[model samples]
Target: MHDIMFHKKIKKTLSTIEEVLNNNNKNIDFDYLLLDNMLEITFSNNKKIILTSQIFLKQLWIATSNQGYHLLYKKRTWICIRSKKTIKKILKKEFFIQTNYLFKLNLLNNI
Candidate 1:
């Protein structure tokens, strides 16, 4: 994808995540910040997850306390290059592991 298109997709994805979190603020115990091309999420336990857009590579990168995932936009979905897992699936698993909270995030459906 072109840089512009990649950026637009990233922005939309981040905004959708932010909207979901905002709407569930009362039910969830976490805080988030969407700055520039990064989304930073901090759970109540102080564990953080950072999602960044790599414009040069046209990929989305996710960082948690233990690991980092390089995700490529493939077949209309963002998938981890190493694990072959969709971003949503990774988040669902990681969030539960990190925060002990099950976050049923379906970014693709929202998009």
Candidate 2:
């Protein structure tokens, strides 16, 4: 993908995360910080899920409490090549494992 498109995707993804967290802030006990190239969500338990961008590779990555996934642009979605899972899927699963809170994200709409 082109640099602009890759960056746009990353922005959209982070914004989606922000929207979800803001909407569920009362129900979910978590805090988040958005940086120039990264988004970090910290749970009440102190576990974190972080997303970062690799501009040179035009790629996005997610680091959960237990594992990390490199997301490649495929079919207009960011998907893990090995697990063939979308970032949304990996995030939902991992957050539940870490915090026992089911994250409701409209990332599919962004996709």
Candidate 3:
């Protein structure tokens, strides 16, 4: 029961992230983790979120039923949002893709 709810939340969150990333030129970093039955998502800005990590995809499933919100994080701070509602709120802000000089340099060097 709880497992189903958790996966739906994760999928919703992931979908939102992917959508935002696709629309923006700013680079977004994502570190996915599973600790003690919790799924942890660490963003490049140092924001993190912990939620139940379970796989639930039934024939009749809905994602919006779960909460959604956004979280703000620094370049490498530790922040966690436990619900989807919070993730949505955070994502509403301006999103940018971060490109490091080193990465650009490497790309240039390669080219």
Candidate 4:
């Protein structure tokens, strides 16, 4: 289990990241955090959901087999790709984009 202080830090960092994403002017619905080398995110698709990944997260300088990052921002879906090779593969393949954000207020909304 994680301590309250640690969780608080993650929450704060997520807020900052949210501002950064929202500034992008896309319609996004998610919050994100960096835990060690992994990123834990809360997002919504047809509905709300949560997800976790340990790779391909550039915001925290972590990369795995994946190469692109997707998010909902400014009411639009946007993708940030790290490498062109990975981007090409992801674009060529038919894959479901699974990503979102979970903010402090989002918790309340879920409740």
Residue range with the least summed lDDT across 10 consecutive positions in model 4: 102-111
For each candidate, the alpha-carbon lDDT, in order, equals 0.84, 0.82, 0.36, 0.34
The reply for model 2, stretches above 4 Å from the true place, is none
For model 4, residues 72-98, the per-residue Cα lDDT tens digits are 111111223334222223322312244
List ranges where model 4 is wrong by over 4 Å: 26-111
What TM-score would candidate 3 get against the native?
0.31
Candidate 1, number of clashes? 0
lDDT of 2 by residue, 1-111 (tens): 788888888888788778877876777788899998899999889999899998997778888869889888888678897799987788779878977777786655546
Residue-wise C-alpha lDDT for candidate 3, range 1-111, written one tens digit per residue: 366654454555444444444444345456655444444555576654444433432211112212333332222211234432233332332122222311111111111
lDDT of 1 by residue, 16-62 (tens): 87876766576678888899999999988899999999989899999
* Highest lDDT model number: 1
**Residue 43 of model 3, lDDT score:** 57
Error of 3 at 43 (Å): 9.1
For model 2, name the residue pairs that clash: none
Which residue runs does candidate 1 get wrong by more than 4 Å? none
Candidates, ranked, lDDT: 1, 2, 3, 4
